[model samples]
Target: MKLTKRLHSCVQLEKDGRVLVIDPGAFSEPDAGLGADALLVTHEHPDHFDEGRLRAALDANPAAALWTLRSVAERLAPAYPGRVHTVGHGDAFTAAGFDVQVHGELHAVIHPDIPRITNVGYLVEGSLFHPGDALTVPGVPVETLMVPVHAPWNKVSEVIDYLREVGPRRAIDIHDVYLADIARPIYDTALGNLGRTDHGRLAAGEATEV
Candidate 1:
């Protein structure tokens, strides 16, 4: 499979001429999920689920579809009919020719007073796992793990520990939109030295074979 990293948490995967996009949110390019055969949203957070972008993508390709949890699915399903599907933990489906297993239940808590919301990760093709906004361990073997390098709900210690726990053969960074450029090397050094796996990141629009 060919994996292309988009800004923030969005990623596009291609195999056998089919494209599946995940988390094409507001922080990502406005047209981030366009041309996808299918799209997956992890949660309702604006950074993870931009309705306008998703609607536009669906409009551009009549055959395209979206899979997401109830909170997000309800917002678009009414318009798309059979094209929008609701999914949750323990669910498995094939999208754009890639096998996807849904994992995780809620987003990481931002604070003691802030309420947590639904969030689901996707283990695609049984090889790569993207845990959206949480440090969810899929409990199944993974070849490549998409690490949310930085976020409000987590710190460097948690990220390193999550990496140690999942122990994939390789890892690439995602959900790093707010990490300042000057502090990037700090994260790089920490995760690279302590993540204990082949870990790295790709610039926006960069692609690598997995």
Candidate 2:
């Protein structure tokens, strides 16, 4: 499988000549979801689920489909009909030739006053796991983890602990648009040293094998 890191929270995964995209949010490139054989949205947050980009992908490729939670599915299902499927935690499905296991139910609390919303993580092919906006433990061995290195809802200590708990052989940073360039070194050292596992950060558009 080939993993391509996209801007912000979106990522493009290719396997067996099929393409599967996750997130494709407003923070990513407008064409981030384009040319995908399938799409998966973890939540309805604008930074993780951009309706226009999804519409474009589906319009351009009629055979392509989308799998996501209710909030996101509701927005696109009406227009796409059977192509947009509503999925939640414990759901297992194959998208673009990749077997995906959905895990997690609620987004991490951003604040005590803010209401929590639905969220799901994807464990792809039993090897790679992408936990959208949350630090969800898939409760299975993972070869590669797409870790959210920086976010408003989480701190480095919590992220460090999450990484240790999930116990992926290796992890690549995601959900990191909030981390400024100068501050990157700070994260790099902290996660690399404290994570006690293989930790990596891929620049937007970089590709790596797991």
Candidate 3:
């Protein structure tokens, strides 16, 4: 499969003429998830879920299906009916010709005063794992792992440890809207040295084989 990283946490995966998009949020291109065969959202955060873009994509692609947490499903399912599906931890299903297993339960704690929200990561095809905002480690072996490099809930040290624990064959940087160009190399180098894995940060709109 081919994976294309969009701005922030949005990622587009394509294989055998089918397209699956994850987290096409406000930071991403407005048409990020357009024409997708299936769309998976991790949470309700604006940076991870944009209602306007999602509505537009679903309207344009009648056959596309949306899989997300209950909080989000509660809002979209009423409008889209059969096209929207709610999934949670341990849930497994097939969408857009790819097998997906949902992992994680809540968003990383941002602060003691802020209530945590639901967040579910997707493990696609049993190989590629996207952990959304959480540092969830899938128990099974992973081929390609999407690591959240920069987020309010996490630090570079935590990222390095998460990568080491998951130990995927390859790791791709995600959730990096906050990172500056000057710090990009620092993160890449840290992951390499501490995590001891092949890691890369795909530029926005850049596609790479996974």
> Which candidate has the top score in lDDT?
1
Residues 145-192, model 3: lDDT tens digits: 999999999999999999889999989999999999999889988998
**TM-score of decoy 1:** 0.99
Candidate lDDT (C-alpha), each: 0.96, 0.93, 0.93
What is the model-wide C-alpha lDDT for candidate 2? 0.93
State candidate 3's TM-score: 0.98
Q: Which stretches of candidate 1 lie over 4 Å from their true place?
A: none
TM-score, per-candidate, Cα-based = 0.99, 0.99, 0.98
Residue 207, candidate 3: how far off, in angstroms? 1.0
Model 1 per-residue lDDT tens digits across residues 72-181: 99999889999999999999999989999999999998998999999999999999999998999999999999999999999999999999999999999999999998
**Backbone collision tally, model 2:** 0
What digit string (tens of lDDT, one per residue) describes model 2 on residues 1-210? 999999999999998889999999999999999999999999989999999999999999999999999999988888998999989899999997999999999999999999999999999999999999888998999999999999989999999999899999999999989999999999999999999789999899999877
Instruction: Show model 2 residue runs off by greater than 4 Å.
Output: none
